[model samples]
Target: MSDATRLVAISPLHSPKSPHLPYNRFLFSSFRFVSNFSNCLKIKHTWSLKPLNQQGSIPISSVDSSSPVSIDLKPILNEPQFDRLIHQAQQLHESLVVLWMANWCRKCIYLKPKLEKLAANYHPRVKFYCIDVNNVPYQLVVRAGVTKMPTIQLWKDGNKQAEVVGGHKAYLVANEVREMIDHEDQP
Candidate 1:
């Protein structure tokens, strides 16, 4: 078994804890401290769980990857606010691409930049967005049949167009999206 699995077996989160290791004690203390701080600050500080790519937040799409083209996967716009985005895209007759990602997923981490670059370069024509899978409801994921992180789904005129799963080369996704846009323009 893997070292991680063995350690997990020894200290299962679902089971009763042992006082032998300092890990649990540290965790409990940290949790308690955070909880107390959160409660105290709850009234004074208003916390919004927006995505990482907000105005002042770190840009998720500027991350370095092993690929040639660097992408920026930051939420160039705002929160999920899908309906508003859909309305805008429909009004402009532009195709929209939504990226579903998780903060902890390594593949998603790697693909973020590429996605962002696509959004930047393709802006005003092919609209792009990044949605944290953690923030979005499970029903949305299940309804969209999103079985993997770093998934990209395309939409046009409020209708589902296509979807790409897993991390893909930036150029390939851009090409596919451009084709979709072109195909859409044909009479």
Candidate 2:
């Protein structure tokens, strides 16, 4: 469905008041606050679940894969942390999907959530991270050969294996990311 025709609901508690919450959602909201913020006013009451015995968060593995769960892609800043993350992922033998983007990039804001949904599909096994090109050292972005606003790269064996430059529409970029992940799975 086209974006303008699509309907979405945003709750106040779904509120991202904290910096710890997903920054991408914050960016999207900030960008279109005038249009979508009205949706928030329509919310008369906050949503709550029927008294459940559970309290803490559930691990993604325990959830059924049939249902798609979209989680925020964790942010990695600075070169040391970036190198350490790659090292950690390599040690664990996990693939890394890194979205090299900046907060100012509107395209990045649109693409981040879609990538997060994609991240959920491969959760734990293939971890996802977002490194802001503007935040990290310029050398890092240059070394990664990133020359675009929203560049999604798949890292395997401590190296970049595939990249999807998110210059097109969000959905198309998402599909290409999925295909990239699927294709990289084979020998």
* Top candidate by lDDT: 2
**TM-score for candidate 2, residues paired by index:** 0.68
lDDT of 2 at 151: 95
TM-scores for every predicted model: 0.51, 0.68
Model 1, 60-164: lDDT tens digits are 344432322223344533335676778788898888888888889887776765566556556556777788878777766776678887778888888777777
Across 63-104, the per-residue lDDT of candidate 2 in tens digits comes to 333333466788988889889988988899888999999999
**Prediction 1 TM-score vs. true:** 0.51
162, model 2: CA deviation in Å? 0.4
Q: Pairs clashing in candidate 2?
A: none
Candidate 2: residue 132 Cα off by (Å): 1.1
